[model samples]
Target: MTTSDIDESVRAELDRLRSSIDNIDAAVVHMLAERFKCTQQVGHLKAQHHLPPADPAREARQIARLRQLAESAKLDPAFAEKLLNFIIAEVIRHHEQIADQPGERP
Candidate 1:
């Protein structure tokens, strides 16, 4: 193939890869939203039971699992850990917000 043809082929491949990544990004965002909704539910449950907003053990277990999955997926484990830490922090904040509202459960 000519040089220009090779370049065109590579560009087509990149475009295809980018489209796949975009789709994955959308799904990831949707999954995160669903997770946040579950966090809100947990906040309500905790408030009702007079439990603490943060669950250290649960968070630890979650991080551990994520790290293992990251390793298996050939991804950066540290990045996965950091990401999960950030997510857990957000969950804590959401829980605290719900807790602060009047008549909110545990």
Candidate 2:
């Protein structure tokens, strides 16, 4: 049913729930930023050590770990895997860029 067709009490509850969702979204963004910052450092380290930008074994292990965590959290494992895959792809890209810049600091 549409919010406009709902009563005041229901509308108020919906508003409250939406506000909580918004706050969670903000927190997620900040957490991601923190994660990326760490990943950037990892990229720099890998670059300096002449490591490959992508680590298939580590990526597989991480995906499995995240999927298990998602299952425990009652979230969709496939969805969580997709999200991590996206993030991993971006991280690999960043790492490749860092590797290309031989002497640049992150």
Candidate 3:
């Protein structure tokens, strides 16, 4: 193939790859939104029961589980752990806010 033809082919492939990445990004955002909704309900329940916002044991278990899943998926376990940690921190922040509302014990 000519140099110009090769360049066009490369651009086409890159565009296709980027489109797929954009779709995957959208899906990830939607899934995270759903997860946060569920966690919000959990936060409300924890607040009602006067439970602590952060659960070390559960967090440990989740990290382990996600690491295993990342291994199975052939993704980087450290990246998975970091992502989960960020999400967990956000969730705990929401839970703490719930726990601070009026009539909450702590």
lDDT of 1 by residue, 1-106 (tens): 6656677779899889999999999999999999999989999998888888999999999999999999999999999999999999999998898888898852
Better of 1 and 3 by TM-score: 1
RMSD of 2: 2.1
Each candidate's number of clashing pairs is: 5, 0, 0
List, residue by residue over 4-106, the lDDT tens digit for candidate 3.
6678779899889999999999999999999999999898889989888999999999999999999999999999999999999999999999888887654
lDDT by residue for model 2 (1-62), tens:
88578999988998999999999999999999999999999989998787889999999999
Better of 2 and 3 by TM-score: 2
TM-score of each: 0.89, 0.92, 0.88
Error of 3 at 21 (Å): 0.3
Query: Which candidate, 1 or 3, has the higher lDDT?
Result: 3
**lDDT (0-100) at residue 54 of candidate 3?**
93
TM-score of 1: 0.89
